[model samples]
Target: MISSTPTTVTDRDFATEVLSANQPVLVYFWASWCGPCRLMSPILDKLAAEYGDHLKIVKMEVDPNPESVAVYQVEGVPAFRLFKAGEVVESSEGAISQQKLQSLIAPHLAAPN
Candidate 1:
């Protein structure tokens, strides 16, 4: 089994964890039945492990968290939203290449505080 650090987020924790976090965060919106979501899990896991300090990666289930779903306007599964200093900095939907994921998050990673 792929070993990735798991940080589960919900409506109650969304604001504090995703928005108010001191570190850049990657919030993954997905469902258990989503094929693309499953495919991307391993990649996300690897990223979480590799960038544990600089980035905070959290997985959220949309079905169970209506508040987060509506709040983020997540209309589809396998959505990735990057947050920096309590603001949404980037987002992507559907299947994403590992390279693309890195590219999208690189700016936030490199940005000076």
Candidate 2:
């Protein structure tokens, strides 16, 4: 059995967990039927653990969270929304490689002074 830290978000918690999070949060919008979404899960889990301090990774199933699905204007599965300061600053759709995901979050990591 594998344990993961990425909080599985629901429509009810989206506002507080993703939108109002103090740090950057990566909201992974996916569904059970989406093969690509399944493929990206482990990568996200790994990234979440490694960047836990700087980023918060969460997943919300569109099928069950229709409200949030419509709110985000997500048209595709395996969609990603990067929220900073309560707003979406970056996003991607479809299956994305780990390298691409890393690049997306790398800039948000702390810069040594």
Q: TM-score of every model? A: 0.91, 0.91
Clashes of 2: 0
What's the number of clashes in each of the models?
1, 0
Instruction: Give lDDT tens digits, candidate 2, residues 1-112.
Output: 1224789989998898888888888899999999998899999889877887678889899998999889889999999999889888888999999999989878875663
- Cα deviation in Å at residue 76, candidate 2? 0.6
Top TM-score model: 2
What tens-digit string does per-residue lDDT give for candidate 1 at 1-52?
A: 2224759999988998788878888999999999999889999988988777
Once fitted onto the true fold, the runs of candidate 1 whose alpha carbons sit more than 4 angstroms away are 1-4, 111-113
* lDDT value, residue 7 of candidate 2: 91
Q: Which residue runs of candidate 2 sit more than 4 Å off their true CA positions?
A: 1-4
